[model samples]
Target chain A: MKATILYEGKHQWTVFGRDPDKPEKIIDTNQYLVSTPSRALLIDPGGIEIFSSMLAATLHHVSVDQITDLFASHQDPDIISSLGLWDQVLPNARLHSPWLWESFIRHFGLNNIEYVPLPDDGGTIDLGDLSLQLVPAHYLHSSGNFNIYDPQAKILFSGDVGAALEADGAPMFVDDFDEHIPKMKMFHQRWMPSNRAKNDWVSRVRRLDVDILAPQHGRLYRGADVKRFLDWFEALEVGVGV
Target chain B: MARIKDERLAEGEVLVSVTVIAAELSEVMKIAKEISIGAKNAKAIAARAGDKARGFQPITNFIDDMARHTLTMVRQIDQEALSVSRICSQEIRTNDAKRRMHDVIRRVEHPSLLKSFQGVVTDIDARLIALRREFDKRLDHLAELLDSINSDMRAATAISSSCRVEASRAEEFREGLGVVADNLEQAVEVIKKHVKECSSRLQHAQRLKQAIYKK
Candidate 1:
């Protein structure tokens, strides 16, 4: 598993992904950790198959008890299927997820953790010292989806919105917007079912002062490439397979 | 002395075996109900025969009692088997969680961070231990229930043999009474077969649970 420090300030944002030791056939995923001094929040903790690797990688930064909160962008297995295992370890932790997914997400084994349901309009996750905004991105893929935006860090944890289906060991950040289009095109077209929802998300994200557009899969879009992705995605016709 | 092989069974296997026990018990319950109905029919025939089937009347009463007892025991065993399945599922989840946490703790190179995991790991370890204990206790209870069913089947076999002896004295209704005896014996045999299979599954699941927790 690779851990990259995406932002370093009073609080830190570290992305853990690109696990070389991941078992064959399972999709690779990127898990984000936002660590304050006394509390930490884990975002989109991956499936059950990668729980050990995710937990081991997380220990490099914040200890187990320090992980006070968990956030699931939606109820996708690749996103939070490890909730049962996490429920065992982080007994006191609160899980912040879409209100619509509260009952569905509990099916993933969430007995001990408190489920702090986020309304459809989205809400804020108060990490004691820092507060992160949960931006709604409904119908972009999942009916009840959200993206975590850090205004101070100028970064958007876009869940599956900016996700691309790339080959294994792909670069962490999009270096060439034109070349990356093919990797992302098929995934967006097939997975993102609503063009209206895609345009809505694009317009909403455009208003945010985002320097980094982090996704849960493949590479992230940063700086000029972030704008390039928005332009390309806004123009592309999605949900074509229907 | 020969040593027992250290066999590893997945939690799903144990759960499936326990669930199969319930299904087998359900079959036993159906057979028991048939036995009860057969006993009622035998009683009716004995009443029609009057003094000719006088001795068979007591035997019919005994068969009815056995069938009722078997039905009650099967219901109890079914409930216990389902409980065992639930406990097994919970124990497997807790065990897997504990194993993953241990892996994380082992990989933590930083001493202070490792120390921070201690409290939570201890808490999880305690939960795993409690679940294992509950699982073992419930499994033992299920074994006892299966044992009681086995004991009831033994009594049933004896009553079935007695039923045959009384059937020969029925005179003109000899063939009718004889058929009733045969049906009772056959029902007992079917129940015995299902009970044996259920007991075998329970034992296998118990051995697997012991082997898993022994480590």
Candidate 2:
């Protein structure tokens, strides 16, 4: 697994993905960890198959006990199927997920950790020293979904909003916005599910002071490319699977 | 490496044994109900025979009581078997988590971080111990229930013998009373067969539990 440090200020943001040992069939996913001095929050901890790799990569940075909280952007397996395993390791941690997915997500066997459900309009996760906002992205793909925005780091952990189905060894960040269009276009059109929801999400994200747009899959958009993604997504007619 | 494989195999064995016990006990329950019905029919036949079968009246009541007792014991076994199965699944999960946590601990090189991981391992260890204790307690209760059923069913053969002796005196109703005795004996045999199989399965599971925990 590759670990990229997106921000290394007072509160650090690291992305773990591109596992060299991942099985051929399963989709590649990116998991982000936001850590403060005394606390850490793991976002979208991936599936059950990749748990060992995820844990080993995470342990290289923070201790198991230091992971005080977990965040699930949606109920998708690729997003949070590792919750049950995480429930076993992090005895004192709390899971922050969508309120609509509380009962549904619990089916993945959650017995140890506390479930802190996020309300429809969105909420905040306080890491003692740093606070991250849970921005609403409902129907961008899932009926109940969210994107984590770290104001301190100016990075938006977009769940599946800007995801692209790329090859195994794709670059971590988008270097060319025009060339990356084809890689992301089909995924957004088929999976986003609603044009109204897409426009709403785009408008809401444009209002935030985001420097890096880190998605759950494929490459992230940074600097000028972040604006380019918003402009392109706003005009694109999604939910084209009808 | 062989020890680890055996432990993993034992983990699955415990769950399978409890499930088989529950399924077999359900068969006992069905046959026990049939015996109760057979007892009722014999009672009616004895009443019709009146003075001729006066010796057989009390035997029918005994058959009914035995069937009822077997039913009660089998139901308790079924419930206990289900509870044990659930606890076994929980223990398996806790043990697997402990193993994985240790794997993580071994991979870490930082001395300070290793200490923090140890805290998580300590908590997992305590939980695994509690689950194992709970599982053992449940298994002991299950064994007691199985023993009670076993002892109770052993009396069926003697009761069937008494029924045969009394049925011979029924005179006109002798054929009917004999058929009732035969059905009771058949039902008891089926119940006893399943009960014995369940006992053997539970004993096997208990042995595996002891072997796994002794280490």
Candidate 3:
């Protein structure tokens, strides 16, 4: 599978289930398009107003019908409020998420799309040549949360855990871990307060040989810095998490 | 009879005039002495009364010492007055020596002849003037001293009054302590009575047990 990184400022998206070079950051949504030889997948496709222009730009190269599956990591407004909008744009796309967050999404009045309950334990969903593994991040910040890890690309799409509040202009790769670690530390302390959850996450990541750690909020971290962050995260006092 | 008649006539006329004049001078001197003695006596009485007031011992001591010194001064002034009176009377009685003395006194008293005797008279007059000035100054000083003493007495009286007030407060405090002591004693007595009653009850219980065992 081929990968193309589409970034707007510090925000980045890895396009694997769709055509490369279509990076979208509209209004409040950050969209990642992953395409295989036959089908395509869009993870956390932002709100309608935000991704509309970028979608237009993306469709210029590939058709909207190419999108076969849509994955929302959690049920927050900024994360999956655009699910209905994505359903309208790609009617055949299946909404894959944890079963726990299905009712939460129904609360948003999105009914037409098929809600595929991803397993609580780690499981894989075939997307042509690449497979998306649903890694459980239960109680990291929310009760029903998971992340997609593509072993083919060695990329882990961490939902919110390693995320920072970096602006769009920040470095896309993990080369600037010194500057980004403080932001990540602050975000973790505020959002992820449980030491047990943090340790569980660190152990999960340590098992995966990740080349890229892309979070929903910040720039992607790559290489040994990813391991360093995991080690640092595991060693931090639990109290500091909150 | 002629000699007795002559002696009586002289004694009744010239001698009587001289004696009356001397008596008048003596009366003046006596009045001066009385004034001085009255002032000295007043000081002594105040000193003695002040000394007897045990609370004002410092003030009394000071007044006693001042009174003794003042008595000595009054005595000296009385002596001086007596000397002046004696000189005036002695001069009056020596009628035979008067003509010769009058010649010397006339020269001394005469302002023109006094020029020759200027040093002596001037010295005497200056001394008298100085004495009068000193007396005036001393009177003013005494008045000021008395005023200061009065003010000090008023201050002492105020202080003594405050001390009395403080003493009353201390008495009240002591009375409060007495009440506390009485309450404590009452509590102790109550505790002792309870202990005695408990002891008697225990003894009665022991006797009842003995009777029951005997039965």
Candidate 4:
């Protein structure tokens, strides 16, 4: 599956599926575009205030009716607050999220879409050549947390774990581990309190052989920086100096 | 011996003459007038003494009672003072805890940049609410204790004042007794001196009569 990376405003990265016979798909913090041979999926459409403009701009070349799925990682405002708005735009779309966070979602009062329950262990959802695996990140931050890993691209879409802050219009990819470590350390110290969960997450990610680490908040990491982050995360778990 | 008897008879005659002169109507009238004046002076002195004693007794008693009660009240005041001090210390401790809880709530409500995630907001809010409720309960308990203690202090103060007044009155009454005793002692000494002079005169007259009879 061919993919076109779109730089959605507000420091978000959207990977759009670029096949002629399929609709588009987006990912991460903002609107994402994923296209199969006959249908498409939009993951984590943002807040309702910006959804319409973002949808119009991002899907300028693609039709909204072709979008088939609206998937959310959890029930946080930044992640699934826009699902209600997306439900109005895409009538035929099914909303997929972990069952643990369903009650939290109902707070938004959205009722038109289907709520698909993802298993605890995780499973793969195939759209022709593109297969997205739902990796459980439970207890890392929230009970219903999960990460999406695209096997074909060797890209792990981390929800908040590997997130970092960047200036507006900054590069999306991490060019240096030395510069990123401070931001990552700050994030881990403030957000992730449980060392056991951090170690577990590190072990899980080490086995994946990920080439690209895409998080919702920060820049993506490629090559040795990803491995270095895992090592540092593991050291944090073991009470070793980084 | 005859000369001695004659001299003794002369002394006896003088003694008899003096006695007869005192027994005369005019002399008796004069003695009666002197006696009446003396009795009138004694009565006047006695009346003054009685007035002084009556005035002094209640004052002395009041002073003595006041002193005793004041002493007891002073002791109680010391105890209540200690209690007040203890209550103040406890109230300060409770207030400190309340301030610390407020600080904790403020800290949780506005977490650091790392916890700026959307999900952490809900957790912080819930925790802050719980902390605030706990702080409120503690403060309410402290306030109630303070109110009760304050009322107790006021009652203790009133009792302390009454005890002090009683103690003062007791001391005054005790001093009055000393003054009355001193005045009574002076009056008794004056009466004793007059009776001694009268007995000496009667003894002289008896000696003269014995000489005259022998002559």
User: Which sections of candidate 3 miss by over 4 Å?
Assistant: A1-30, A238-242, B1-215
lDDT of 3 at B11: 24
Per-prediction DockQ: 0.72, 0.57, 0.00, 0.00
lDDT of 3 by residue, A1-242 (tens): 12346432222335422212224442222446666646667777654333333444344334455667788888877677656545444545688888888888866446457889877785876776667788898777777888888776677888777777754444555676676677777777777768898898888778997987777665667788788778877876644642
lDDT of 1 by residue, B1-215 (tens): 11235322456677899999999888889988998899999999999999999999988888889889888888888888888888778877877788788877677676676777788778877887888788778888887877887787788788778777877887898889999989987887888888889888888787766666565
Please report, in order, the local distance difference test score of every candidate based on alpha carbons: 0.87, 0.88, 0.52, 0.51
lDDT of 3: 0.52
lDDT of 2 by residue, A1-242 (tens): 89999999998999999998789999999999998878899999999878878888898888777899999999999988878788888867999999999999999879989999899999899999888898999998999999999888899999898899999989999999999999999999999999999998998999999999999999999999999999999999999966
Model 2 per-residue lDDT tens digits across residues B1-215: 11334787889988999889999998899998999999999999999999998989998998899889989988888999999999898888788777777766665566576766676778889988898888889888988988887777778888888889889988989899999889888887887788789988988888877778875
Per-candidate TM-score against the hidden true structure: 0.94, 0.93, 0.46, 0.46
Q: Count the backbone clashes (under 3 Å) in each candidate.
A: 0, 0, 9, 25
lDDT of 2 at B136: 84
Show where candidate 2 strays beyond 4 Å: B1-10, B207-215
Query: How many clashing pairs does model 3 include?
Result: 9
* Candidate maximizing lDDT: 2
| Error at B163, model 2, angstroms | 1.0
Q: What lDDT does candidate 2 reach at residue A158? A: 93
Better structure of 3 and 4 per TM-score: 3
